[model samples]
Target: MRILLAAAGLVLVYAGIVSLVSPGEPAASPQPWGFGTGVAVRPPEVSLSGGLYFKTYLWARGGGGVLYLRCYVYSRYEGGTWLPTPEEYPVLGVYSVTVGRGPFTEGGALNLTLPLMGGCVPVATPSVDGLQLGSIKVLAPGANLAASRIGLYVAYAGGRLGEVTSFYGPGDLPPSPEDLSLPPGQAGVLLALARNITAGCGDVSCKVERIKEFLKGFTYDGTMDAPWPHIPPGVDPLMWFLQNKRGVCVHFATAFVMLARASGVHARLVVGYMSDGPVPTQWSLTAFSPHAWAEYYQPGVGWIGVEATPPMGVTPPAAPLPRETPTPVATTPEAPPASPGPYQWPSIGLGVFLPLAGVAAAALVGGALFKKRVVIAVGEALRVGAPRGFWVYVNRRRVGRAPVEIVFDKPGLYLVAAGPFVRVVRVVDYRSMAGRAFEKLLKKLKLPPSATPREVAERFPQYREVALLVEKLRFGLRANKEDYRRLKEMI
Candidate 1:
């Protein structure tokens, strides 16, 4: 009894300390990391990222077969202006996003280069009840498998797409996340264009509409292999695209993200396939199908996705030819690309190295650190895969089966057994900073300590469904998938 009491007291102390130390770190929406899903957000020098998915099956002439899936993900905008990935940024001065490897996770894995070193992308599998399942088996005849077929599937968070379409600026705009500061000349051109494109538009929504409409003019060239741009070899492609005025999805999306960021709107470039495309009854995909887009962040709501390129099956007219200009070498003068958008092409990012050391770098002037170092969340549950499911046990006794959900409030012994082996589990809670965000939202809504569903619905009609679910959660109705869906929408 004495030992058990002492253990409980320590756990309580630990939780208190975590609550105090981890409260203010910024965290955006729950974006599951992906293979090939990264971006290079250097102000005038940026690069995009992209990925493709494939699966193949092998068959023998006489009897059997085998199947395999391939996931290829790359996060760099190859051939962009070359900037070395800095080994480390000053921690205190510049908010850092540290990407660390997690525990013995399974499935298709690959080693990536510097820019891609965030987290592994989540691949999809046949799943139920938020659980993913896969397996492998061996057969006697290995080489006999000659005749083979392949399948291709694009894994994406479909739920993320619709969320982007509904952009709701907060009634009371909160602070925007940390972001890259644009050079003065660069900021001038971007803000001028935003003002012109969003002219007569009273609000953010109108501004976004005008900007999207203006961007659609770039058109989907579908010519990914076309030479990037005629600017000096080191100039950013989108900057060239801005002056030349034509490109594929990558060019359009990249330009939109940069413009949005410069216009005081926080944004990011996302690279993934069009998972919701129409395909043949048989599993298939094409090289021309890889795609990219942009998402801008809202204060309390999170990142919202939007399309800057034209919809599929709609191709625009060809681009106008750019005037000939001498190539710039070692600062020797050369006329810039043709079709300039607004300002004269300012010599923004060319060899202009801002000294990032001493008080200058230590000041953390333009850097924005919006994301937190990834951390494990308490009460998070994961399923152990099994054919007929597996048994869940507690304190040496069987409690239930594989999908047996458990949220440990205090330290305890737990187990997940599959056939002959039993994996012992030690349960503990990991604190996170999201609770502070929710509290801010609540305070913004001006609700009391015990806000009723009616009062909540009245305050936030947009989240009437969420308000109802909160009431249900209060009454001990376990939060389900629907609750999570609602939370994503409301938050």
Candidate 2:
């Protein structure tokens, strides 16, 4: 009875600890388009929720560094939202030579396999001479949306993948009015800020440079709330970012376009993935790689790409202030929104786990001491009987006669019988205990119960060693008990 009570107490303690630390399951986002497959047609509208999508693969032989996979280009800015002009030309049977200027330096072909997460098909090529559509049916220069499974025969120059720049030709029409449109209500402040940043700029190129430099000074924080969900309802996201000066790629790119347009430089917001490091022969791109940037039109050279977002971990110089004070614009009286600090998953886990760990250690140690006392008491009681032909059985398996000592390789409750006496003994292994606790941690992270060790490692790269240990135990492989002890203390 005493042994059973001790085991039950330990179980209850673990249950309470789990209840305290585990978080409710996160709500899953709706995915209208199938994941990891190509789509036949573009969707009418798409929403951004900042959730991760399926992975896409790209295979390329040549060129590297910030491969600009051109997707959608938004020319119109209505407040905080961007809209593309309604103009698409058919380029189904046209050869690459007849497009903008001719083919750029022929580099190699790039094969892209995309999942059906969004409407636009991202196309990256080294050719800056023309908008190479390959066999794609429709081409929207203003919006650049296309069907999936896009293939481009890229042409290279200086080992950099060229963007879709040829469409904005020297003799082509000027930028649309929509490209220069500023957000309502905040137009005055935006124009004033733009003029202030570009005070010494002599031409459009100089103004573009000034705007890019100013935005680079702001911090790049991806943990903040999505742009659409600004605090104090109905506040423009761009205005909020300008006030805070810290945001993700979208915030930085949108601000750049707005500032450039206000300064009479025709610019558009481009959404795509930026392959930052060295490009391997085959690259696997995840949803985490989605990025946004700005492009401004230069008369003779066409639209040139400008990276405004500061590189990760590089502290840029302080943003320049206006040389002279401008007229004040009336604003709301609401308090400024707070900046969301760096990613906090690691800190949050530590904060919740530390206290519970202390309590768990106490409970486990108490259980172990009580278990040792019970075992000694049972041995004494069995030895005094001194009956002939005495026998002992564990879990219905007959082991030996009197004074039997049995060993268990795993942790669990087992039935032991000695002659007429029968009792339940619970075996405990610290390694197994830690493994169960790790599983509970996985559940708190919203991973599926059957998630594989590899999947868990992918989600939390920091816990990779723990995942490997768990994998060994699950698959009946040889696992180091000492390794578990060291890792537990480290964690």
Best by TM-score: 2
lDDT over C-alpha atoms for residue 206 of model 1: 60
lDDT of 1: 0.34
lDDT of 1 at 265: 72
C-alpha RMSD values across all candidates: 29.0, 22.4
Please, what is the whole-model Cα lDDT of each candidate in the order they appear? 0.34, 0.46
> Taking the tens digit of each residue's C-alpha lDDT, what string does model 1 give over 233-313?
556565667776776666776677667666667655544333222222232211112345565655545445566776641
In candidate 1, the residue pairs with backbone N, CA or C atoms under 3 Å apart (3 or more residues apart, or in different chains) clash, namely 34-121, 35-121, 36-74, 164-305, 178-368, 179-368
Tens-digit lDDT track of model 2 for 127-190: 2223222321222121222232222111111111112222212223346677788877888998
Listed in order, each prediction's TM-score against the native is: 0.32, 0.44
> Best candidate per lDDT, number?
2
* Backbone clashes, candidate 1: 6
Worst lDDT 10-window in candidate 2: 153-162
